[model samples]
Target: MPYGEAMLTIARELVDKIVAHGRADHPDEACGVIAGPVGSDRPERFIPMENAERSPTFYRFDSMEQFRVWREMDDRDEEPVVIYHSHTATEAYPSRTDVSYASEPNAHYVLVSTASEDDVEFRSYRIVEGVITEEPVKIVEAYG
Candidate 1:
């Protein structure tokens, strides 16, 4: 099926994994991609990527690592269904740079905020042509 046709349903475990990665890199943004079978619209593989910039206010995938990951995904006939990152001191929303750098119009852009000491705000959006549209995220125990 085509992407963005339905609400994104992510496994709870995957959500935890993303949150854990964010917490682990607290004070600095964490970035990664979840790959799924091409056209599946299902995020099934959690692939944590190294943030080249390693800045709390910025994130950039390591060029070599990204190339390798993309090549692997291509070999597996998969694509990035979800592109995610963390915001250490900001809201779980895309920054202007994020929107500008968004090249995956078919991928869900997920943002996690580790700014709150008591709560973590996780949100998802579709950034197409520089337009950001918030989408509902349904967390499930598993995905079949």
Candidate 2:
């Protein structure tokens, strides 16, 4: 499938999990990946990754940890369907750095904003060739 062709459907529980992680790591960005069976387009596994940068305005996955996680996903015949991170003080939108760092053209880039304190701003986008295109996100009860 192409990068911007399909609407991303994420389980509500998974959304909750992501939001919770964002809140837990408030003031610092939290990063993670959602792995699913290849070609499935259904995110099934939520693997919260450590923010190596640990900075409020930036996030970088730990090198060794990212390698291990990707290796594990490969071994399980899975791929990262969604690459997610939190925006501590900004809106739920990708920053210039985020666009430059996005290497997965086919993965949905989800950004959660914990800026509101009382509200969670969740949004998804597709970043390809440094261009960001917002996509619709459908929260479902479960993936079948």
The 10-residue segment with the lowest total lDDT in model 1: 1-10
Provide the global lDDT of candidate 1 against the true structure.
Answer: 0.93
Candidate 2 segments exceeding 4 Å error:
1-5
**Each candidate: RMSD to true structure?**
1.4, 1.2
lDDT of each: 0.93, 0.91
lDDT of 1 by residue, 1-144 (tens): 236565778999899999999999999999999999988888999999999998999999999999999999999999999999999999999999999999998899999999998889999999989888888999989776
- In candidate 2, clashing pairs total 0
lDDT of 2 by residue, 1-144 (tens): 344356789999999999999999989999999999987788899999999998999999999999999999999999999999999998999999999899987799999999997889999998889889899999999776
Clashes per candidate (backbone, < 3 Å): 0, 0
| Candidate 2 collision pairs | none
lDDT of 1 at 55: 97
Provide the global lDDT of candidate 2 against the true structure. 0.91
